[model samples]
Target: MARDIADDGVIDGLRAAATADFETARAMPPEVYTSDRFLALESEHIFSKEWYCVGRSSALPAPGDYLTCDLAGQPIMVIRDNDGNLRAQSNVCLHRMSTLLQGRGNAGRIVCPYHAWTYNLDGSLRGAPAMSRNSGFCKDSYRLPQVRCEEWLGWAFVSLNPDAQPVASRLGALEQMIAGYDMTRYSEAFFEEHVWDTNWKVLAENFMESYHLPVCHAGTIGGLSKLDEMICPPGHDAFNYHTILKDESLRIACAHPSNDRLSGDDRRMTYLIAIYPSLLITLTPGYFWYLSLLPKGPGQVHIRFGGGMSDDFKGDADAAENFRQLKALLDDVNIEDRGCTEKVFRGLSSPLAQAGHLSHLERPNYDFARYLLDRIETGQGAV
Candidate 1:
C-alpha cells in the first residue's frame, strides 16, 4: 500500500510533459502526491528557499508578542521586538535543542521552559543559568539562530534559507492586481488551522481553480460561481490566479454592501491565487482569506486558513455580525474541500490512477504542475 517515489523517473515523466498546452496538459503522476522521497526533495528545493507567510503582522501588533510555527519542518518563531520590528528565528533552545515556545503569547523575554535558558526578543542570550560552567562558555557569544523575516501589506513572512529573496520582488504584480483593496488596512477577523488528510498539492490544486465550485462546494459559495465565468489566466513565475463572478442573486454571497464604492469587476468578482509553494489567497472587495499549506507527509498537510476585512468592512457597525456569517460560510467550504481532497489522496493509489487531461478550468493546476516540475528538475526558483 506504499508508493514508490524513490525513482527519479517518476519526476522525469512529469518534466517530459511540462510543455503541453493547458487543455492537453496531463495531471502530475500519482506518486508525486504520495511519495516520501519526492516530498523531501520539495522541502529542500522549494519550501526551504521560499519566504513563507506565517500570519498577518497585526497578529503580533505589540512588542513582545510572538507566534510559534514550523515551515518545511523548520521550527521557528515570529515576534515583535522591543523596537517594534518583527523578527524570526530558530525557536529551538541552544542549551539542549528543546522547543522554546508554543502557540502565541506576549513575553518580554523568551524563556526556555525545559532548561530555563533566557533570550531577549532580538534573540540574544540573556541568562544560561549554569551554562557558564562550561570550559569555553561565553554567554555573550551564544544566541538563538535568526531566520530571515519580512512584511508586506501587513502580512509577515519568514524564510529558513539565508539567501531567500523578498516576497515583494516576486509578488509585485499580484499586489497591484488587488491594489484597490488596500490589503494593509485589513485586520484579521478569523483564524483557523487544520491538519488535513491529503497531500499538500492536492489541497493546493483545489484552491487554484473554481472548476470544483459547481460540484465540490455545491449549495454554498459555489452556488454563486459558474465555471464559465472563471478566468484562468496564464500564471506568473511566482503564482497563479483566476477570477470568478458572484451570482447577483445571493445578497449575502455578493460583495459587501459597504463596498459600493468599488467599481466594475471589483464589485462583482473575486480573485483567488496560489503563491508558489503553498500560500492560497481568495480576495474580494470587502474581505480576503488565505490558506498556508505545509506538507506533513505524503498523505497529510498542515493548513492555516483565515480571513480579514477591508477598511470599510472592518469599520462597519455590523462587522462582528458579518464576520460571524463569513466564518460560517468558509467553514462549510473547508468541509467540502476536506472531503474531496482526502478522497483524492486515497485515489492516487488506485491501480487505475493515471495522468488525465486538464480541463480549461484547471489551467492553474496545470501551471502548478509545471511550476513543480521545473523546480524539481532544475531547482530554478530558490532565490
Candidate 2:
C-alpha cells in the first residue's frame, strides 16, 4: 500500500524526456521538481554517493582552519590539520552524538559543548573528561569517522561513499579543457550562503544555459550576451559545459593584459561548467565564480556562492576596482536569477504544468535530466 519512490511511470517519462538529441528531447517530468520522494532518491543516489564540492582550497590557508557542511543530512567537517593536509570527517561527537562545530573558524581541538568531549584537529579523540570511570572507555577506540576528501584544481570536494572514484580522475577532461585559464591560481575573495525557494535543478539549469540571459538578467549582464555566440556541447559523464564570448566592453570578463596563454576567441570566452551533482562555475579569463548547491527539499535549495579574480590580474593597478565592479554585477545577476528560477518552481507545482519541447539552447538541461535519471535508476537497481 506504500507509494513507490521510483515510480515506473515517472522513470519512463524521465527517460523519454532526456533523449540526447535535441530534436527529440523534451523537458523533464514536473514531478522531478515537485516530489519529496524523488528528492529522497536524489539524496541517496546522487548527493550521498557522488563527490560534493565544499569550496575553494585557498579558504583554509592555515592549519586548524575549518568549515562545516551538512551534506545529504550528514554533518561533515573539512579541516586543515597540523600536517598541512585537508581532512574530512564526521562533525558529530562520537560520545553523545552532538554536533562539534557551528560555522567555520580556527580551532585547536573540536570540543563538544554538551559534555566537553574533545577531538584533535585530525579527528582522533583528544580527551573525554572523567571518562576513565567507565570500564569500556578507551580513547584509542574513539575517533571521528573519516570521509573521502580530495582537492581538484583549487576546489575542495568530499564524498560520503568510501569507494567513490577520485575527483581528479573524473575531471581530467575538464582540467585539460580549462588548462589555459589556470583555475587553480585564482583565489577566493568572498564566500556566502543563501537559501532560495526553488528546486536545485531549476537554478542549475538556469546556469547551464544562457538562453534566458537577455530576459532574466536584463537589468545587468543580459544585453551583453548573443545567442549565436553561445555553444552548448554534449556533456561528459562527470560534467557539462557551454561557452560564450564576452562582449569587448566587459573588459574584466576578458583575459588580463598579462595573460599570454590564451589567444583569439579563447581570450574572451567564458566557460560555464556544471560539475555534476552540483558544482556550477562561471570561469571567465580574468575572473571566476561558482555555486555549490544542496537541496533543502523539493521546494528549496541551499547555495554556497563565491568567486574571485585570476592571478594574471594580481599585479594590475586596476585589479581591485575591477573585482569590486564584477562582484556588484554578479550580485545583481543573482537577484535576477532568483526571481526567474523561483517563478519556474511555482509553475512546475501547478496541476496544468506539463513537460514542453526543448530549444536547442537547452541541451545542457536535457543532459542534466539524463544524468539525474541515470544516477537514480542505477541507485534503485543497487537497492
Candidate 3:
C-alpha cells in the first residue's frame, strides 16, 4: 500500500517551509516529489482546477485546426471552429467513449476511429451511422462537453473546472508589466513535446531560479551572465518573475533597432516569468520561449516547449541567422537542465536526502512552494 501524504510528515515540512522568510526558507521535502499519494492530491486540487496553457493561438490559426492534450487525466482538445473561434471540448466520443481525435491536424469535423460517429467543428453531433432504427436516438440531444478556454495575449488556456476564474483578470498586472514587449506579435518558430525522467516541480524550480547557471550552463549562456545584475523581486499571487540584462555580444537578445518602446537597460533585459501551477516563459526583447509542464506521475514530466522571434527583429537583415543561432543555444541549455533536474530527482529518492537552505536567487522557488501548499491544503480554485 502507498503511504498517505498527510501522515508522512511531508505536508508539515512544506507548511513550515512555505511560511518562512527567505533568510530561513528551505527547499521542499523530498517526499513531495517522490510520493504517489501527494501527486494524486496535486492532480485533484491543482491541475484539475487551474488554467493550463495550451500554446499560442497562432498554432491553430485557421478553422478546423486543433490540438489535443490530457489535462489531469481528462482528454481535451482545443480546436478552431468554422467561425475561427477557439473552443475547448471533451475529446471523447459520447456513443462508445472512444477518443475522437489523435495528435493534431486540420479536420473538417471530428470523426471517431472506433465508429463512424461524427461531430461538427462546433462539437454538435452531425451523424451516427445506422442509428435510424433506434427509436430512442435523438441526434439533437448530444454534444461534446465544453471546457472553459480563454485567450490572453494570443496564448490559449484551458481548464476543466467550470467555475475557474478568468485568466486575463488574474494576469492583468503581468500584461501591463510586459506591454512594451507586445508578446502577441511574437510568432512561434517551433513547438515540440518531450518527456523527461524527473518530477515536474523539480524542472519548474530549475526554470524559476538561475542560481545554477554559472556551473550547470557553463558551456552555453553562463559566460554571458552577470550575477550581480540579476533581479529577483517579490512574486504576486498569480505569478513570479526575475529579470537579467543580456550581454551585448548576444545582439539578438537585445531589442532590435526598430523597437522604440524600450530604452537603456530595458533594451537588453530578459524576463523569466512563472505563471503558477505550470507555465514558464522567457520573454526577451527580440524573442520568446516557453514550457508548459504536466506531470506523468511521481517521477516523470511531460513538456510542451515552443518559442519564436519577436516581430521587431523580423525586418533585420540577419534575422534568420540570428534566430537559428538562438534556437541552437536554447537547445543546449535544455540539455544541461535535463541532466541537472534528472539528477536532483535521483538524489531525492535516496534515504539520506534532506532539504537545504535556499539562496536569495531562489525566491521564486519559495513562492511556488507556498502556491502549491495553499492549493493542495485549502482546495483554492485558481490563482
In angstroms, give how far residue 18 of model 2 lies from its true place: 1.4
lDDT of 1 by residue, 112-217 (tens): 9998999999999999887656889888998889899998888888898787768888799988887866778567877878899889999999899788888898
What TM-score would every model get versus the actual structure?
Answer: 0.95, 0.97, 0.97
TM-score of 3: 0.97
Cand. 1 Cα-lDDT:
0.83
Poorest stretch of ten by lDDT in candidate 2: 1-10
Across residues 47-131, which tens digit of lDDT does each residue of candidate 2 receive?
9999999999889989999999999899999999999999999999998899999888999889999999989999999998988
Instruction: Looking at model 3, report the run of 10 residues with the lowest lDDT sum.
Output: 1-10
TM-score of 2: 0.97
> Which portions of model 2 show Cα errors greater than 4 Å?
1-6
- Model 3 clashing residue pairs (backbone): none
Candidate 3 segments whose C-alpha is farther than 4 A from its true place: 1-8, 380-383
The alpha-carbon lDDT assigned to residue 8 of candidate 2 equals 68
